[model samples]
Structure formats: structure tokens, C-alpha cells
Target: MSKLTPLGSLPYPQPTDVADVPLHLQSLAEAIDGRTVLRFTDIANLQARVTNPVAGMVAWLGTPGRLFHYAGNHWAPVAPGPVHKVNNNEGSTTSTTFVETLTSATGDPMAVSFTAPPSGSVIVTVGAYTYNSAADGLAYMSAAVRLGTTVKLAAHEDRSSIVRSAARVSASTQFQVSGLTGGALHTVTPAYRAGGGAGNTASFDNRFVRIDPVT
Candidate 1:
């Protein structure tokens, strides 16, 4: 009697089975390594600064914005100076004072972000509200850009104030701007509460994000 193997071939240490050897050859698959990969250098950053604007435009890229810090927030030339940095609330707050400088006593809050404007332009949106203690009211606010006492850019009634709780529900306004530079001095233009801080606690988050190039 002969011993049998699983494939009808005699079992051997390394499959040296002799009983079931094929007369002809069979296609064998080559062993493949575990991973595939690729890599390349990033050129977008340098391309714009070095290459012509037309070439950068062909790639659908635009000139980068001027970056700077102001009024306790980060700003970029992309949106003039209305946008804000991550920690817009340089300080904390916990009050109902109708003050513009968002602080803890006046409700430190964050502003929603906006799209960057085309080169040489800035824009911001704001709403207005009445200084009511119990419920929110419709009041107007102003956004102005200034440089050492000189108002370089101005947008009125751009953003509206809201009850700390209602801010998430209300729609935001936008301020359009042009003729500004990242190197210039600027601020959110300011939002003045018409009446005054009502007993009701209304908070404001005038923070914004600006996107542009690094120069």
C-alpha cells in the first residue's frame, strides 16, 4: 500500500511531492510586496510668489493674502481686517453690558467665518439688535476699518447683535471692502449697540477667519 497526500502527491518537507508532479509547466504568480506609494514636492506655495500671476491663475490659484494680528485677533489681507484668528476672545466675559470690545463682563464670543474676497478687497457681514433684557430685539451695528484715527474702510449695519443663545440661529451680515493692505493697521471696524446693554445677557462673537498666502 502507498501513502496518500492531500493533492494526491506524496507529502514532503517543502512540497517535494513526487507522486503528483505535472508533466508540463504551470503559470506561477510572483510574490508581491505589501505596499504601494508615491510622493512629490509641494510647489503651490512658491509657484505663486515666483511664477507669473497668469500661470498661477491657470492652475486656479490666486495671490495670497497679507497676514497680521490686530484687536486681539488674527487677520489676513484676503478679507481686509474683518476676519479673526482662532482665539478672538483675548479675554473672558460673563455680563450683559452693551459694550463693543467683547470681554467676559460683556460676553466674550466667537464670530462665524466668511469667504475671502478677491484681491484688493475686504468684506464682512453684521446684524443689529435692540438692547432688551428678556427677549432679543432688532438693532443695528456698524463695522469700521481705521488706521491711527483715520478711517480707511467703513461698512455700516454689517453685523447684528443677538442674545448669547440666539446668535447660533440668526443669519450674519457681510461687509464689502476694497483698497486695503495687510501691512496697514486695521480693526473689525466696531459694532456699537444703539441703546445700551439691557438687563438681558446678549453676547457678541465678531471673530472671523481670513485665508490668503504667506508672504
Candidate 2:
């Protein structure tokens, strides 16, 4: 009698069966033809070798050490993209209108730029240590995450005689932007503003921004 392996169903001949050696060998060879991951030097090599790849077929590229799988129409990476982070602790704004946070004395905005993946969303997070100069009445400080001229996320906190004057508070905002243009460069910026009183000031320090891409 003969049975088949559980996974690939390769032929397994019993000792009592006495099957022909050539027949068993041919069956095994046919069953194992496309059972292993195809290896190539790079994407070009993979494309040259595999012209008619079916869905679920996987290939390993040597140059970048990435695994790709065919999705019936295109090949996609198995791993997510890398994360980007930037930090700055210089400069402050007192305007009531939202503006880019400066990272340097020369007025460089606290911004981070990265390339967006072909088909995925990006998550942006901004955080800072906030300060309001006014002690009496209500004072508010707002922080926002911006992509170009668009504001992705914004949040504000009010401090009205809650604690001692000039106390520092933490303000942060996070947003996920989807349907981004593939292979496009994206710049994320953090902004801040102040309101609720005359001669009041809002300041930010120890600012940080992070970007993550999901595919």
C-alpha cells in the first residue's frame, strides 16, 4: 500500500508495496517543484525568473533581505516600513494663531520629512512640554500636527487658577493619515498657539515628533 505525506502529499510507498523506483521518484519530483521559497538576487532577478507567479507564491531577495509575496496582481513586502522620529527643544511662539514651531534660532520649523510607501497610511505624533504665562483668569494652550498647510490633529488645554502660576503642562496630539500618494515626500510639522487673555503667552519645550508607516 502507499500513502501521501500530510503537507505536500509526496508519495510514500510502504515496504510491502514494492512499487517501481522510477515511478516513486518521478512522483516526488513533481510534487516538490514549487513547494519552496524562490530565491533571487533582487527584484529584477525575481521578475526575470518568475513571469507568471500565482497568488501566495513567496520570494526572497538577497540585496535588501526582504521577503515578497505575490498578491495575484503585484508583489508586496511582508514587513512594514520603518519609523521616523525628530526632536527639538528650542524656540517658542506667543501668537494666538497656529504657527510652525521653531527648532533653531534662525527660525527653522520643527519638522520631519520622509518618503511615503506605495500603499499605506502614516501615523504622526507630536508632543511638547507646554507653559502658560498667565496665572489669573483662564489661559489656554493649543498644539497641532500639520502636514503641509493642512492640520491633521489639534488639541488644547486650559489652566485657570488650577495650580501655581507658570506651571508646566504636557500637550500632545496624534493622527493617522491615509490614502497618501505613493513614493511621495511628506513633511510633518508641529504648531502651537495661545489664547484666553491679554499679554498671556504660550510656550513649548522638549518637542518631539514621530512618523510611522503601515502597509
- Which candidate gets the maximum TM-score versus the true structure? 2
> Tens-digit lDDT track for model 1 on 54-127?
21111212333333222112222322434444333422223422344544523332323333333445555554
Instruction: Provide the lDDT at 23 for model 1.
Output: 24
Candidate 2 TM-score, C-alpha based: 0.51
lDDT by residue (95-178, candidate 2, tens digit) is: 666666542423346567655555747776666666667754222333344446665444444311121136776656566767
Q: Once superposed on the true structure, which residue ranges of model 2 sit more than 4 Å away at CA?
A: 1-78, 103-107, 136-165
Task: Evaluate model 1: give its TM-score.
Answer: 0.36
TM-score for each prediction? 0.36, 0.51
Task: Provide the lDDT at 74 for model 2.
Answer: 65
Best by lDDT: 2
